[model samples]
Target: MNDKVKALLSILESAGFSHDDLAGTVAELNDAVNDGKSTSIQLVSPGAAARYIKRINDENVFTARFRHSDEPDLLNNESNDERIENPNQDSCIVVSYDPAKQ
Candidate 1:
């Protein structure tokens, strides 16, 4: 899977958020004038995604995911141990402004 998909799946798996729990998920993004809305079924709630990313970032499990071979940073003798410190900006998903996918 792509990094975003993998990262999210890892978060969900780690958080014990099963596929059933995703039924209530809404990809929302609220701003000063709008109450946020659903952008797509293929996306996750930006707020929730950011929160989980941050929470999991501190966990050792997430640290291993970052160093996994599929990512663009590792090899025989070198590695990048950078962590996900900014979930809001680091997440591949985009927030919405439409306020409703309904």
Candidate 2:
């Protein structure tokens, strides 16, 4: 296996996947590739992948809010518990994981 494949397998193993499961998945993937099908895999940090797994298994949600401004004073005010309404940029995202719902 190439370095990338080896790295992915290692990550999966570390994430508590069984050897037999990995082998079966690899076989299926190989079959797909041989049949001229395209596949895509994303590599992420171990911590991020672990968090994703935990969220999915626990059926949890992750939410985050971000604000951006070119002014230094605005950022400093934000840290002081001041709300900057309608800043230069603001965004909020919510992600929920529930395989059963899918």
The digit string of per-residue lDDT tens for model 1 on 1-102 reads 234334445565554556565534322211211333223222323334545545544542222122222232222232455443434333333222232322
Per-residue CA lDDT of model 2 for 1-102, tens digit only, reads 433334445545665655675675555444444444443322222223444444333432211122223222232344544454543233211122222333
Tell me the spans in candidate 1 whose CA falls farther than 4 Å from its real position.
23-53, 56-102
Among all windows of 10 consecutive residues in model 1, the one with the lowest summed lDDT is 25-34
Q: CA lDDT of each candidate? A: 0.35, 0.37
User: What lDDT score is found at residue 27 in candidate 2?
Assistant: 54
Candidate 1 residue pairs in clash (backbone atoms < 3 Å): 36-99, 37-99
- Steric clashes per prediction: 2, 0
Model 2 spans with C-alpha error above 4 angstroms: 30-37, 40-102
Best by TM-score: 2
lDDT of 1: 0.35
* All candidates: CA RMSD (Å): 14.7, 16.4
